[model samples]
Target: MTPISSKGRTRGGLAALICGALAAGGLAAAGTTALTPQAAHASSHREAPLISGTPQYDNTDLYAFVSPDRPDTTTIVADWIPFEEPAGGPNFYPFAEDAQYDLHIDNNGDAHGELLFRYTFKTHVRNKHTFLYNTGPVDSLDDPDLNVTQTYDIELIRLKNQHVMSKTKIADDVPVAPSNVGKASMPDYGKLRDQAVHQLPNGAVTFAGQADDPFFLDLRVFDLLYGGNLSEVGNDTLKGYNVNSIALQVPTHLLTESAHQPVVGIWSTTQRRTAHGSYAQVSRLGNPLVNEVVNPQKDKDTFNASSPWQDARFLKNVTNPELPRLIESIYKIKAPAEPRNDLVDVFLKGVPGLNQPPHVTPAEELRLNTSVKPSMHPKRLGVLDGDTAGFPNGRRLTDDVVDAALQVVEGELVGSKNDLGDAVDANDKEFGHTFPYLAEPTEGSRGPLAKGTSGGTDVRSQLGDALQPAGESRNTTLIAASAASGAAGVLLIGTGLAWWRRRVRRPY
Candidate 1:
């Protein structure tokens, strides 16, 4: 045989070492390998480069679970990045028909076998009218038939053994729905709304349509830190004030593999038409939005490519395994030595933190352990009270994920007795009490404005000032200011009490 190249020999040796370690450490018997420090840091978010601009395909978040609000059923919430403009009207956002959206679950730690739930949409244009309708001067309006009818059907596919074996239509021949507040007849928007609020056979309810985008992140602040390098540190600017959203609610029985203890993972996918008329698609195939990870500048066009599917294949290659190391290297900070392998156990294993894990996953996919009983009318601020249904489970539109994330970063969730040290809450934004649960916009309403006018003034400056951190003093002027800011304080107080007490005590 020809002599093996030095590089090939090295690779072979490394593979043997890995296998030997797994077997010797007894991990092979457990069907799991302890993620090496490097491998633990390799976990990435947002794979497709083009997804940066296309929030519809961004797959910003994946949530799987037995619903806390409705324990008998399971709910899968997939949040896409780059929030859409709610008023990006004319063509409201809808899931791509050809695209395959999936929710995956790896019950074993090997991260190989996954129970996949896929979704596909088929558009149905009821009326071939170009324009939706004309509002002000019907006579003067260029397009009188501005109101058009559109509908789409939704299909769910279950993937096993790398092939789709079963398919179910969540919505059978449903109309393209519109916002609920609009007139019912002119567009008969109610029909669409009604179609969305249908009841499934298992007494489980499913709603899929355009709802108020619930994700609220201070994108402007992030941009300021990395892009503009602004000095306004205590500012809170919600750049994604409005966006298109797709919401779904399913019974828990449907998700669980045998009503025993339900556990699952979820993620979304998007596809687009290639220049060749054929389509290109992306799946769990690659790391999402590499621009956010590697090269922010050169990755823009890469993120905008029409063929995201092609990009998925090379995802694992581009991913830097020592991502946390890279960050620490760049920042010139020491990497924390608090057991990185245990992170999956703490973060993804439903360990209480500033927020609960969205779901339980064998390897960090959005995991929801159905064995955990659902909380009836559970408090939304989960980690504060030790409820596992909140943030880490499936993040709700109203979840204070920023605050939750901050707490985790500060080591607040792991307990004061732990060597990692205790952390305190920094940001404060509670959620509303409904589906698509985001705090109601500070702006009053959405309607026709004066000739030369604008809608809601930026509430960030005001709200940010009122909510800024007060340093070591637990009761600072900022807290008082927030307390005085209308009913916000009451909600905060209630949620805070629940969080403080629940966090202090462990609940099974």
Candidate 2:
């Protein structure tokens, strides 16, 4: 059996990651789903029709990794609300008071959340009958001028037999960071962000706020689906979009059952109160683009409400994905055959000895091996580029899942590098490289001149060094430029070991 070594990581043979796992029957682990391949970039945006109508409960993205800044702890960031326009006045984004946000971990590989982190919100309209979100310049998160404010309660629950065995509210009535309307209302947005950070008794750090969207991708790929060619200039559609984010950082011991099995599966979900007062799940996401690309139109909603244990039904989608065929349609290349064992290994069971749990039972999740040390110089292309700490091992804010997923979808392990890409490489704002790493949201209403505003551009832009060739030792690529209104930054980096790209007939 080909051990699921980082063999493909050193070369462009990512398909081997699957090939090896297939030999081991990695997909037999169970509770796995067929996900979207080479089709889209963003992970879980408005994936289903119902979620499209309810942005508040929609989970846009989920990132879990060893905290680069604090390797002793792990960071799991789940973003809600999509494509928020900073200038949207009156009522900016807030965690839906009636909704329940949750992060699930399956460390023991039961395809169930052995531990669950739940967040519930409550909003207070301090200034009733006021049209302004803020009556005056909001000097701080607690400023009286900020009329609409929200507070959240966080709970860490232990689950057994799909029931909560114990639930502890880690933090209660923690105030949410007010939205960054603009310089006029928020003089120092960073201070507001700092004020929102809540320290819990259990040694956990949590933050909930409106922040710049860190998901980077050219969203225009969905325009044609399998019919047309992607526009050469499909810019990163998510640029400038802000989101409601919940970031939690906890010690490694809190996430894992024992040091012997440090690998864990991660997923985020949202539930809303129905008229009957019962909560109903509206969205769920683990890996990127699974719901958006894998589930058929009719089943997208079903997939959202389904559980990891019931994911076997969707296995056909992965074993027989159409994403490669779609790429082949435009490029006239030979696509992989049925039972794409490679994808099953990567998306379902995870790479063995890497992110795969010791006794995993096959589930769709973003798996991370807690034992892996945070890399000093990470590669965005992830395992494909030979980075131990990148995506498929546990994703970081900097992991280019879009590019990695695209290559894996094309059967890179089988020596197929369709070289499909969105061309949008990096994020618009600078990631903090610390807790709640996503950059601050773009200014909307304007108060004090915020830092790093050179012609409305931030000095530490996430997209600053993207789309460039991957270094033999370190790689980078230009994924996106600065947002027009917010921080207009640029990025440059590329996938590992670039090969000759053969552009087929331009379908566009």
The candidate maximizing lDDT is: 2
Candidate 1 residue 144 Cα shift, in angstroms, is: 12
**lDDT, residue 338, candidate 2:** 66
Off by over 4 Å in 1: 1-48, 53-56, 105-117, 124-130, 133-146, 179-195, 224-240, 272-280, 283-335, 346-362, 374-381, 410-508
Q: Assess every candidate by TM-score.
A: 0.57, 0.82
Model 2 per-residue lDDT at 150: 92
- Give the TM-score comparing model 1 with the true structure, all chains together: 0.57
Candidate 2, 1-508: lDDT as tens digits: 0011222345633445555756776354442433322221126777789889989998999999998878889999999988899888878888898888989888887677899999999999886887888999888777898898999998889997579899987889999998888887787899999999888776789999998899987776666642264444336678778999999999999889898888888888888899999998778888888888777776788777776756776777777877778767766657877677677678877786677776566668888988889888877777777677888887888887877787777777655654556665577677997788889998885323354344655333443444335552222222233333243223212221222122233343
Off by over 4 Å in 2: 1-9, 12-17, 23-42, 225-230, 445-508
Q: Which candidate tops TM-score?
A: 2
Q: Judged by lDDT against the true structure, how good is candidate 1?
A: 0.40
All candidates' lDDT scores?
Answer: 0.40, 0.75
